[model samples]
Each structure stands twice: as C-alpha cells, then as structure tokens.
Target chain A: MAQFRLQGSKVLAVDLAGDTVKARNGSMVAYTGQMGFKKLSGGGDGLRGMVTRRLTGERMEVMEVKGQGTCYFADKATEINLVRLNGETLFVESDNLLCTEASLRTGTSFTGLNGMASGNGLFTTKVEGQGWAAVTSHGPAVILRVSQGLPLRVDPGAYIAHTGNLHRALKSGAGWSTLIGEGGGEAMQVEFTGEGLVYVQPSERMTLGGEV
Target chain B: MSYPPQNPYGQQPYGQQPPPGYSQQQYEQSHQATQAGMPLPPQAPPYQAAPAGQFGAPLFQPPGGEGPQLWDAGTLPANDNVNPYCFSVDLNGAYYLQKGKMIAYYGEMRFSGIGRGALDQLLERNFNSPLHASDWVVAEGRGKLLLADRAYDLNSYDLEDGNLTVRSGNLLAFEPTLQLKQSIIPGFLTLIGTGKFVAASNGPVHFVEPPVRVDPQALVGWADCPAPCHHYDHGYLHGVLGGLRHLTGIGGASGEEHQFEFIGAGQVLMQSSEALMADRSVGVIGAEPGIPGAGVPHQQQQHGGGLQGLGNLGDLGRRFGL
Candidate 1:
C-alpha cells in the first residue's frame, strides 16, 4: 500500500515500499530515496485498453514508479485532489487524471454527447480497484453529491469527474432563441441522477457550447 | 443523449433509477462526522459511500494531509460562498446570472434567455440593460446553484432598499427582488431596491468614503450621493517649454495626472488592482437628441473627447477658476 498525502495543495507525495504506482509521465517534481520510473504505454490497462484509449481519444501517457521512498508528483502546479477508491469506479477526463495506483484498472467509457459540448471527446477515463487516484483542475474542485431524487446539473466545461452508478443525460437548452443573439449562454448542460459524487472546478474550461 | 429542451417537468429522463442509496441515516452520520472534523467511524465501506464536500483544491495543508473538509448538499451553505472563488445561491424562485457562469447545481432548474419568452414580464421588471441582453439569462426553479467567473475573487453584498452601481462585467448574479437598470454612466448598471448580488473582482474589494479621487480602472462602483468628475494636475503647464514638453512627451508626463474626483457623502468601492474584468456592453442609449448621455459614447466621455496627454490642457481651460 502506498501512503498518499499532500506535501502542499499542489504536490502529491506517495510513499511506496517496493510496490509500484502509476503516475503521469514526467510529473515528478522531487523525491527522496531510491525510485524507478518506466513509461507505460496505453495507461497500463493492457493492449486492448491501449487500442480502446487510442480510439476513444481518452489517451493517458503514464509511468510506473517503484521504490522505497517518497515520490512527489505535480502537473503545472494545478491543484491536486486525491480520491481513495475501494472497488467502485471513478470516471474522469483523461487530461485531469494525474496519477493512480498501479493496481487500479484504467479504461475508457462512452460518455454519449456529454463530451461533444465539453470537447473532451465522446469518451472519458474510468479508474477502479482499491487505490488512491489523484486528479487536477484549473482551480480547486468542489465535490458534489447526488442521491436519490436529488439530481445535479453541471456545466460541461466545469465538470471534471464522478463516481458511483449514476445515469447521465446530455441536455441542451437551445431553441429558437438560441439561433438569435438572445440565447442563454448556458444552452447546453449535463444532468446527473441516481447515487454518486461529482467533481466540478471553481473555474470553467472553454467549451464548444460555452458561447451560446 | 437527447434530452429535449421542453422535457416534462419533475420527470426523470432516460428511465434512470436512483440506485439503492446510502440510507439517509448513514449519510447524516457521515456528514456530521465530516462537519465535526471527527474521524469518520467507517460506518460504511469507503467504496460504498459517496464522498461529500471538497477534495483536491486544498486551502491550506496541515503538517500532514488527513484530507480537506468536504461539503455535501446538506452541509454546503445556502446563498453563501463555498470558497472565495465560488458562490452558492439557494434558488427557490429566480435569479439573474451572467450567462455561462454556473458551474454546478443540485435540484430542478430551468435557464432561459431574457428575450421573448414567458420571462418577458419578469425581464421587463428587473432586467434593463438591452445591450447586455446577450450576456444574461434567467434561471428559475429550486436548487443550490454554484457560480464563479474565471476563478476570480467573489463577494456577495446585501442591498436593502438601497442602490449601488457596478461595472456590468463584474456582476455575476442578483436576486430578482432588485430592479436592474442601465446606469446614467455608460458601461455601468445600477441595481435599485433590495436583495443581494454577487460581484467578482481581480482582488478583494476595498471600501472608501467619497471626497476621494481614484484611478478609474481601480474603481468598482459607488453607493449614493457622490458625483464623479475629472481632475488633472496642471503644475507643469506654466511655460512654453512646459507646453511643448506636455505636447511632445519630451519631459515625460506623470501617469497620475488624471483621476476621478469624488465629493459629497457616500461610499466608493475599489478593487485592489486596476486590472478590469472584460467589459460586456450594456449597449448604446440610442442617439436620441437632447438625452444627456446619449450618442457621445462612454469612452469619449471618460477620456474627455480627446487623447489624455494633449487633452489635459484643453480640459483645464474649460474648468472654472482653476
């Protein structure tokens, strides 16, 4: 087991004792002790997963870190979030996934049209198994919970990830007014239902549907 | 994937079932535990329970990261900020928000354009900036709506039977109870009556009483009684050499020659920095003859109808008893 803790808000320190952890390629800022780094093609999900990642455009280039010391990982100094997963899956943008435990399974799942407006692709990365996965965002991520009868609506640009067996539907508020300059700028949205947790950044990414 | 714009209200789309949920009991306990900063007793498997509150964007890291505090729906504040950069509006009726500013929300809500719709009557009452019509939307329903603007510093102000004028671009959202109208000053919008509103600034906002002169770019807005006028320091315009230098920049001009002088009573709001939010045009007031602020354009008025370096002398000649 790797001890995942924050050295600061922007850095992730994972202490490993001979076990390996998968992390973003070239994300090491500093480390103390012996460490081995190796690039893993296809996110270490295997050949089938590699081809699936290439096809879905949710491609993640990662490296395996095996050692007996504390390894630091960071991405352009963006805020890092550490999520502990037991068995359930975590769905996140491939670009936002900074690192994951080697034991976790990584693959892609069709996100329907929700990715079209977000421009992250029609697929997103799914991480499962027991491990701590670290994600990044432009600003701090606000974790929101959606339970039975209490659904959540999130802007495509602000959405980062989610967990649980929730159902997602792509929604568009576009109409005759949208054709005019008077259209609501938030003409597109993603609606989530069922049980789950959602991650949204305090900032929004520029998306195809953002200007409507 | 295809959610119709007019989907029936209160109906779940796509045959989605809520899944066997964490009993309300378990959720309440974990929520309390997290709120109390108590170690979660592992009432449920970490894999089975949904993580509530915040993670990732840590405010401050303790000696060791036990993890940041989380805020679930029950704990997320109503009509307050989740962080300095994010605000939450507990919406039971309606709110007017700048378009595309919402990051997330829980519950049912419908966002509609301010133009021709059932919102016409409401828009007629609260929304008055027609040029900015394209930049705003009316969100109606019940939910906790989160808002942010490019991750800037956000603050909410309560206006009770009072008025405050703000740069159109800095305002994020406002309650419908406040009537919004175009300010007599172009590029600014005035909100009258009561209710609360959210505004973002490059830095935290600072308040100062009027009878003060401020840099135009640093000013956010003012509340009541203070009238803004242009001011210039004419110390160097005494000789022909000075005149030529002022005209050619040969002797250099003090960058602080111009400022907006305010007098009388009232409060002036200023952001720490001069960096401004992108301007959203409130549109022209029309070129109608005899209307005081019509046709001249705001830029020209603010700049005194000419370039700053050369226009200062002309403006001085026009001022009384200078």
Candidate 2:
C-alpha cells in the first residue's frame, strides 16, 4: 500500500501510515500533531550564526526528519518516486532508503564480505528479492547510465547514489583532481564501471567519503 | 639399517665402481662404461671402512675419494624425513613443524625465524619457537597473524603431489602466484578438497602447499599510511578507516557534512548533527591559528612550564614565565 501527497513550499513528504506509504508536499500539508521548537545557544558568532541561518533554509547544514507519522513543512525537494529492481538484492544509502518490503538484516560496514569502513561509514541494506522499498533524499536523485564500455569514475564523497551489478575500484584522472584543492593530493576516487545505475550528488558532501 | 645409494634418475644406473679416492682416470672410465647396462659392483664404490689409525670410522668413501660418500647412502647417518606429503593426525606439532607453510608466534623471538640465527637457536632448544618446529613460522611477533585475522576458502589439496589450492581471503599477506581455485558462495566460506585447512566463518577454503611466488605488493595493497595524502601521519587512524571505506563501502557517509576542530595536539571537536551535542558543543575556544579557531592568536604554553606569573604578568612576563 503506497500513495503520494503534495504540500508546503517545495518540500516533498513521504508519509508511511499504517500499512501504506503516503508521499505528500505543498502548502496543504501541515504539522497536525504537536509543535516543538528548541533554541540553539552558546558557541561563538560563527557557529551560532550558522545555526540561526539554518532556520531560514539558506544554509547548507539542513536538518531532515524521516519516519512514520505526519509532518508540517518541508523545503528544497524536487521530485519523489518508488523504484524497484530484480534479483534478491537491493543497494541503497542509509538516508535515501525509507522502507523495505522484506525484513532487512542491518549490519555495520565490517559485516560485508569485503566492506571496509569506507563511505563515511554509510549503512547499506542488502534487500533480497522483491517487495517494497521506500527512499527519500534532500533533492531529486540523478540516475546515470554506467556500462562496461563506458564506465564512470566518481569521488565517493560526491556519490549521491548508485544501483546494479557494480564493482568499485580506486580511480584517478587529470580533471578529477583539480577540484580536490591540491592536485587531489591523497584523493581517493570511486571507480564504478559496469552495467549499473549510479546516483551522484551535485555538490561535495564532507562525510569523509573520499580517498583515504 | 642402511640405505641404498639414491640414483638421480629413478630409472637408470651409473656404470663401474671407481675406487675410493678414484683417480681422474678411474672417474672417466666409470662415467663411460656405466651405461653398458650391466650392474657391476653397483657401478659406484661400496661404503669404505676406516683404516687402522684413522680418527672417525670411515663410513663410505665417495667414488671420487676427496669428497664425502658420493654413491653410497649407507655412509651417512639416518634422520627423519620432512616430506610434506606425509602427515599423521597424531603427529601434530612434529608434522606441522616439518610440513606447514604458515606458523603463528605467540610472543617474541630473538632472531628472524628464517635466518641461520633462529635455526641454530631452534636446534639448540630442541625445535620450539612459537608454533613448534614443524610449522613454517608465518608471523614473527604477537600481532602478526591474530585469530581475528581474515579467512578465505580452500578448494583443492593433492597431498600425493604436495599441491594445494584455496580461495582468496582478506589476508593482505598472501602469495599471489600460489596455486588456487576460485568459487563463490554468497554467505559462507565452504571447504572443497581434503587435507588440513582453515575455513572462513562465511565459508571459504584454505589449505597448504609448497612455497610459491607471493606478490607482497598485490596482497597487501598498500600500508595504512604512506597514502597519497601529505597530511596523513602514519599514526592517524581516520585515514585507515577512510581507506577501508573507500575499499569496501561498508560504512558510507550519513549524507551530512561535518566540521572537526583540532582542540589541541590530541583533542578534537567534531561538529555534526549526529554528534553527541547534549553536553558537549561542537566548537573550540582559544584554539591556535591555522587550527580550528579561524584566526585566534594561539598561546604556546610549554608542557613543564607551569602557571606561576600567569595571573600578575601581562605580556612578556606571561609569555616567558610559562
């Protein structure tokens, strides 16, 4: 059971009510339950200023809320939808994946066969077969076509998303290093070359998701 | 019991017997005539008994008198065989000391295990290093190959031929040229052939074989430090974790940016929504320049330099006194 709703500014809402998931956004959506606001204090002007700036939705430090129930307002979201794939496997980010059809076995980065403590320790849920998979993000996700002949190398830090039969390796190219602030110095890049779909974040997220 | 002389080629034989201390003439004659196919005096000379006044009993004189017994095995003292092909479940330490390729060391060692120093010590001590004489010592010290060390799969083990095969493990220190068979099992490490071997928790087979070429570079990738980053200190653990992240993608970022402040030499302030902000905040005060606090004039306080004139002293006095 799943549904979509539009409400508040440009914020997209994915509501999981009982057995169904409802996606809503626009001005019509409102916080019906209770409202709680806590003032942030202390710290110097820079940090305090940043926190205060976040309230206006102009800062990069954005707080996102996702769970079951209702929400009042959301902003800076473009599009939202449900995507499904074959095989007994589903790869997704910790934040993007909202719910799964089958029971998921949650584990740390080390639990994987060769999974390292990489990607800023991003938690991934390996879903088996098909059922229901719900996901959300700050903005619309970009699905890029990656194949064996024309593969893509991305900085893991800039990797917003990806899915498929993908093998990851370390990558280094000329233009890619320029953005790293020093010829990419110990810049570790993620090489995704295979028949799979990759999602990339527009901006670099400083979650320690780059080369070691 | 005496051993017959070993023929280099199992099927053939050398010709006539060269007298003890065979003259060059005798050697040439023996070498030329041995292939005639007649078994004459076993072709090579018999074991030579010591003459009257000689020091030790002469076991057997070599065909060429100058060297040790060349053709007679009976001349030499008997010793146990260390053939890896043979092993008894009951033999335990003795067999492994002679056959195993990797051995663990529980503590420290006085000398490098392979060199003559350790071997000499081993012989003197009656064959006991860490894992025993039979086990080929793999690591030298306490943390060499810990139990927590990763595991792989074993696929084949032909004991008769002394050949073994195994699936790759997370072992950064494996020999690449070593023979192995590859197979995939989604969730478990499975054993394939026979012979003593270790199995991965998820099921991968691992077994022993004769020493083969091992590519140290390929096996270990690169050390934790020595990475491309200049700011990377070998002691910094973050880069190691990050490498693991880059390598395995096990724990990825939480899709949030974070700011870390170097409070002191060893202190840090990680500022993120995920951080424990209940009691501790994310910023730093009095932080040195080029550090966390944007442009704060860093006060260089010496370690042993106590706060004596700190209260009364204004500028130079406080700066110099401590």
Candidate 3:
C-alpha cells in the first residue's frame, strides 16, 4: 500500500513500499530512494479505455510510479487534495486528477449536457475502488457535503470532483435578458442532489457560458 | 551632484510618526466604531467569525478525516469568508454581483441580469452606473452563495454611511443598500451608503493611511478620501537626457516614475503585489469636452489614448534619438 501526504499544500508526497501509483505524466518534482517511472499509454485504462478516451475527448496522460521511497508529485503549482475512497467512485475532471493509487480503477463516464456547458467534454474520469487519490485545484478546494433536501449548485468552472451517490443536473438561469446581452453572468450551473461530497475550487475557469 | 528631495509633497517623511488622529490604529478604531453603530437589516444573517481552520493554522481537528475542512450547508459560515480566496454570502433577499464570480452555493438561488424588468426599480435606486450594467447581475433567494474571482484574496468590508472607490475589477459583490456609481477616476467605481461589499485583490490587502504615493497597479481601493492625482517624478524628467529617455527611449525608463499621490485624511487600500486584476470596462463616458477619457474610441482608451494615436511618430522620433 502507498501512503499519501502533503509536503506543503501544493506538493503530494506518496510513500510507496514495493507498491505502484499512477500519476500525471511528468508531474514528479523530486523523490528519494529507488523509483521507476513508466508512461501509461491511454491512461493505463487498457486498450478499451484508450479508445474510449480518444473518442470522448477526455484524454489523460498518466505515468506509473513504482518505488520504495517517498515520491513527490505536483502539477503547475496547483493545490493538491487527497481523497480516501472505500468501495466508492470519484468523478473528477481529467485535468484535476493529479495521481491515484494503483488499487483504484480509472474509467470514463458520460456527463451529458453538464459537460458541454463546462467545456470539459461529455465524459469525465471516474476513479473507483478503495484507495487514496489526489486532485488538483486552482486554489485550495472547498469540500461541500450534499445531503437529503440540502442540494448544492456549483458554477461549472469551479467544480473539480465529487464522491458517493449524487445526481447532477444542468440548471440554466439564462432568460430573455441573456439573449439581449443582459443575462446573469452565471447563466449555467450544475445542481447536485443526494448524499455525497463535492469539490469546488475557489476560482472559476473560463467556460463557454461564463460570459453570458 | 546634489539629489532632489524624494519627499516632494513636503509632508512627513515615509515611516515617520504620523500626526495625532491620523495613525493607522485610530483609523481602524473609527472604522470599527462606525460598523458597531450601524443598524443591521431585518433579513441580514447574523455575522459569524470565519471558521478557525479556514485560514492559517488549523485550530481544530478535521471533522472526520485528515483532509481539508468539510463544510455542509449547516456548517458553512453565514455571510463570511470560507477562506481568504472565497466568500460565502448568506443570501435571503438579494445581492448585486459581478458577472460569473460565483463558485458555488447551497440552497435555492436564482441569478438574473440587470436587464430584467423586475430589477428596474432596484437598479434605479442602487445601481446608477449604466455603463457597468452588463457586467453586473442580481442574485436572489435563500442560500449560501459563494463568490470568488480568479482565486484572488477576498475580503468583505462594511460601510456605515460611508463611501469607497475601488478598481472596477476588484469589487465582486455588494448589498442593495450600497448605491454604486461610477467613480470620476477612470476604471474605478464608487459605492456609497451603508452596506457590506466583497472585493478581490491579487494578494493580501494592506490598509494604509493617506499621505502615501502608491503604484497604480498595487492600489485596490480607498475609503472616505478624495480621488488621488498622478505624480510624476520630477527628477526623472528633469535633464535633457531624461527627456530623451522619456520621449525616445534612448535609455530605459524606470517603471516607477509615475504614482498615484494621496494626501489628506483617509485610508488607502493596496495589494501586496504589483500584479493587477484584469481591467473591466467602466463603461463609455459621454464624449463631452473636458472628460479625460472621453472623445476617444473605447478600444483606444484601453491602451492610453494620447501617444498611441501618434503611432509611428513615436517610433520615428525614437529612431532619430529625439
């Protein structure tokens, strides 16, 4: 098993003892002890996942790190968040997934129109199984819990990932005013319901519907 | 060679003891006094201190794990900052927010643009800046609305019968009680009346008393002060060589040659870094005579109007070392 920790808020230090972890390709800043880096073509999801990723445009470049020391990973100085999963799935954007334990299975799932509004394509990366995975955000990510009746609405640009059972629906605030260029700048939102946790960064990425 | 006095304003030198009643502490005390004296609205949520672990060191252990603080709707602070980069507004009635600054929210909230017919009366009273109409929207209903801007440091300031002028892009949202108007200064907006507003800065914001000259890019806003005037370093533009450098770029000019000079009694807000927020159009002023930024086309105003229109004249002059 590999243990994940933070070396400051931006760097993720994973201690591996004859275990393997999949990370963003070339995200290794530094490490100690023996380490081997192998590029995982098609996100190491096997041939089927590679074809699915290519078709869905949810492409991810992954590398497998197997070593006996503390391996460090960072991506563009983004803040790293650690999620511990137990027989559950984590739905995250490929751009936000920094690393995942080899025990976890990675795949793609259709996100419907919510993906089109966020400009992240119709498929999102899904990490399942019991393990620790790392996600990246523009700033420190705020973890919000969605329970029965207490629904959460997120601007697509700030949404990074979520876990547990949840239903996501595209909520549009666009009205006649939006067509006349007087619409709410937040014309589109993703409404999440059910029991789960949502990861939202404190910043917004420019989206197609951002200006409207 | 003798050097000219750097403190050309003839005021107290920088870092010296400020006169009585003008100290930073006194300003903060008076600021708090005003806040304390103000009456809270009926629907306004009770203000809560920001969560302890949201900033700096974690004072309390995480609820159930070793990760960041997990905030549910009930745990979210009411009308307070979730972190330095994010502010959570406990929304009941309404708020005017800059376009697309919302990151997330809990509960039921509807965002509408200023052009909605129902908002006309609200706009007439609180929003007076017609040019900025397109960039602002109204958030109404019940919920905790989160606001952020490019992950910049966010802070909320309360105004009690006071006024503040801020860079247009730095202001994120405000209550309806505050009447927003265009500042006389280009690219700045002024808020008047008693209300709370959230603003974003590239880095942490430092509140400094007036009698200060600040780099334009570092200035976030100012409170209860007259607008600042541009001050060029006289010594930098003194000699013939200086004129050549200024006009022809024969020698590189120091970027700090120009600053916004502030004097009198008030507080000025400056960011820690020189990085500026993206410029938001303050809307086109009427092309009337004597308006500094008027008469020029909107696109030309962004690049600074005068010399840009001359075009190759400057390049041609630089070629001959004019």
What are the chain B TM-scores of all models? 0.73, 0.16, 0.73
Candidate 2 lDDT over A22-74, as tens digits, reads 12222224543333222223111146444543432222222223334554334
Q: How well does chain A score by TM in each candidate?
A: 0.96, 0.53, 0.98
Q: Over all chains combined, what TM-score does candidate 2 have?
A: 0.27
Ranking, TM-score, top scorer first: 3, 1, 2
How well is each residue in B215-293 modelled by candidate 1, as lDDT tens digits? 9899888776689777877678656776666667787867887788989877788888999887755556788765556
Model 3 residue A122 CA deviation in Å: 0.2
Cα RMSD (Å) per model?
Answer: 9.0, 31.6, 12.8
lDDT of each: 0.76, 0.29, 0.79
Give the least accurate 10-residue stretch of model 1 chain B, judged by summed lDDT: B35-44
Candidate 1: regions farther than 4 A off: A16-20, A32-47, A64-69, B1-73, B230-258, B289-322
Task: Put down candidate 2 lDDT per residue, B1-322, tens digits, no spaces.
Answer: 1112332222221122322444546434433422121111112323333332121211212234421121111111111101111110111121111111121111121112222343454333332222122112222222111111111111111122122222223211222122122212111112222233321112321111112222221111111111111121212113656444433446654422221111111111111122110111212332455543334756665545454432221232333333
Lowest lDDT 10-mer window, candidate 3 chain A?
A142-151
DockQ of 3: 0.37
